[model samples]
Target: MTSDSMLREVHVRDAIGLVLAHDLTQILPGTFKGRLFKKGHIIREQDMERLLDIGKEHIYILSLEDGYIHEDEAAIRMAEALRGENLSLTETHEGKVSLISDIHGLVKVNREFVDAANAIEQVVVSTLLNNSVVQSKGAVVGTRVIPLVVKEQTVCQIEQLALQLKQQAEREAGPITVKPFLPMKVGLITTGSEVYNGRITDKFGPIVMDKITAFGSTVIEQRLAPDDRDQIVAEIQYFAELGVDMILLTGGMSVDPDDRTPGAIKQAGADIVSYGTPMLPGSMLLMAYLPVGDRRVPVLGLPGCVMHDPYTSFDVLLPRICAGETIERSDITAMGYGGLYRC
Candidate 1:
């Protein structure tokens, strides 16, 4: 049949045994709204009454030519082009396929690839923001083509583009991937004379521990230290000696004379990435890497706000750190744009 005659709209009574060209949706005000007949479904005799009740007097039937592709097939091909490691694809439904995470990790997307894909006519690939944290089975991306029957060449262009991009990057994976978090052994040090001297109960350790555990890591040991710079430095060295993957020092990060966490981190032979950030509630945060025997361990000097704030710079960087990323000054500086949390 010619392209113009590829799709035929027939009355519901005559549609029996014919395949549906696309999904048919039914809506009952505030009661229900969903697909009544999926794409490619062979219309049945029993479906006539229900189809008529949903006001489906006529429905289109697809007789695709060699050069044309159905939406379901197009969606599957598009998802294959976009699927990366640690991601799973859902069955195509209503011309769309969703990308789901197979593990709890950070979702990374190539924004340039997404932009280029969307630039192709009738093609759609939508994704969550790059570097988003997702749990197992969370949906991260959706892929589909706009039309019920797209020209096969259109879909091929997307596949070729993905191939070219991957080849150029010298990687085997596609534009989207989930990097799993590493279970790091952490050492925590609470630095404040008020808590170290037993004048007040320590709260920072518990909060820090909770955050670490949530990311599938544990605090190997928790140490208390007075505000003295040497004492704080000594605790940092001790954790380095223990070969902890990460060290977290909470409190005393401010510029106050008695607050010396930042200086102590530097004194302990760490390469400070950033001693401060532009993010509120975490402006005094410190990020560093301390050299061990063969590897460098991440050391963070968290500001006082971390003990109380629901989300701070610590929360921003911890996941990346746990994912085996080296925190950089650029990363710390970039947090400023979306960093304002308090009113």
Candidate 2:
């Protein structure tokens, strides 16, 4: 159980040296080959004269010149061995909760409590990273040892809390059923003469489709419409009749004279909630709700950037929308991470 005992059990060869170098290309892909202490671990990039290494680009050199193994460095090596099995914490998961009042029914409440806790913890973490502080009374869910009055917390601390909670829960109870969330049906409206007329390929449709898939939702209907306002308006009404849950209008969202997507959306009798987002590359994103009888069909007009970049204000906001998120203008205006646009 001791650190020293565990390291010895790993039997990482005690190659006493200023630097212990290991060619990872020669080692297994994801095997945590024990704790490597003695520094001076050098990496000979790719033994290029040999077979081409897939995906390996850079080399890591672990040096012991500083002397003594930092507890963190030693621990990271061991953690590598427990890769996929690690279920770090989350603030929201698609787990169901049955109240204690229904305890007589066939359900376990404790497991759901743990899941809910994890979700809260993750949200707390997300807030912390953005420099926002949570009050003691506002501790995140599933946070072990909550009542956390800590002033500053790192990502690792958040991850550790999640891991510990998972281990403790697994010991105390049997696994509750983890249900897959019901996928919402989505409809895509691609608007642009260039794309629709083959002046340029329609890359925007696939990008939106991928987002739908990532959310575990289905793009039940997809249509390519030119910058013609009438076509856009007619199709929106047509899909409304088709009983679609959500509609996405891409391109032709800008303020250009040719941008008819927004006008057509309005003509569909859909109430525009927000005409544009404040985020760059996604400034033209629009959100609206079309009242279809008893239900409100959520509609989003994505910016042109969503086609080329994978992550944008749209990407972050879309999931929250799918989760039935309530949004204020302030929420949409806060996404200013110029460098956070990841694909």
Candidate 3:
């Protein structure tokens, strides 16, 4: 296709390959183009039809990062090429700032910073990096910044910054509000003969339960799949059919000969979100999301520590998932310091 005037468009299709801005003409006129287009740019419908003539081919656009090959889509479908933690940021006229608090040292510094700023609006804060007390007003808002730090609350702070910007925009634009998506509903699937047959007291179930609940969700369904792969897969599928937004499979996450959760998950037609988070005690964890009709239900394969430990890698992530926050590999990668690194 050829045109006299220059235009730019992003094309998205399912086929996975690498292409360039210039090569897209095979799909559409070179005039349809992008400015400052980079990897992971999302493409919309008009661009799709105009580019690949999507109806005629099996190609489906995944992301913008794939040269002109894949573009970003809002369906919450992340492409394999998308990397790092987006962490979700929003912008006002004020510059981007991270809130670090609850620790005595930075809280004072943060308070001073907020108080001094003339046009500041939102703050991203993580409290208690140290065992110090903050003497300032516990909560600050408006020209004030709320002391948003809580134990392992770094993700919460990041989320608040994103929301604060959105809220401020709504307030200024006119009254508009909508509920953020509810945390993904997760069903806990613990696989072990001991737990399933009642040989042991089912100690691990409680731990998984507590952790799930802490992340702003209730374990609406819980079950034991035993050591059988078929049973485990079936239970997971049953939960999927039940409409649980996520499924958590505890125990039997290891490479032991008896471990069947991983194999069962693969057989279940579920795509892996991630397996083996780098954090300890939960290293064997597995995360996958599968579609039930149109919505995705994430299933988690949590290892042992989700019970005994106060926090693990899952603790850092589950809330983001439960909050309907997308877990890009980068989000998990940022926890390298165990949420100790601020923002």
Q: Give RMSD to native, each candidate.
A: 2.7, 14.9, 23.9
Candidate no. 3 TM-score: 0.50
Query: How far is 218's C-alpha from truth in model 2 (Å)?
Result: 0.8
Quantify all predictions' global Cα lDDT against the true fold.
Answer: 0.90, 0.53, 0.50
Can you rank all candidates by lDDT, best first? 1, 2, 3
**lDDT per residue (tens digit) for residues 1-343 in model 2:** 2223222111122222222232233444496443322222432223332213333333233332222342333223212211121112222211111111111111112333344434643222111122121222331222122221111233344345446655886652222211122368888888888888988888778778887786668999888898899999988887888898789888888889999988888888888778877666677788888999998888888888888865666866676665555456676666665534433
Q: How many angstroms is residue 224 displaced in model 1 relative to the true structure, after the best TM-score fit?
A: 0.5
What's the count of clashing pairs in each model shown? Answer: 0, 17, 33
**How much does candidate 1 score in TM-score?**
0.91
Candidate 1: residue 245 lDDT (0-100): 98
* Model 1 error, position 25 (Å): 4.8
Worst 10 residues of 3 by lDDT: 74-83
TM per candidate comes to: 0.91, 0.50, 0.50
The residue-by-residue lDDT of candidate 1 on 24-132, one tens digit each, is: 8999999999998899899999999999999999888888888998888898999899989999899987789999999999988999899999999989899998878
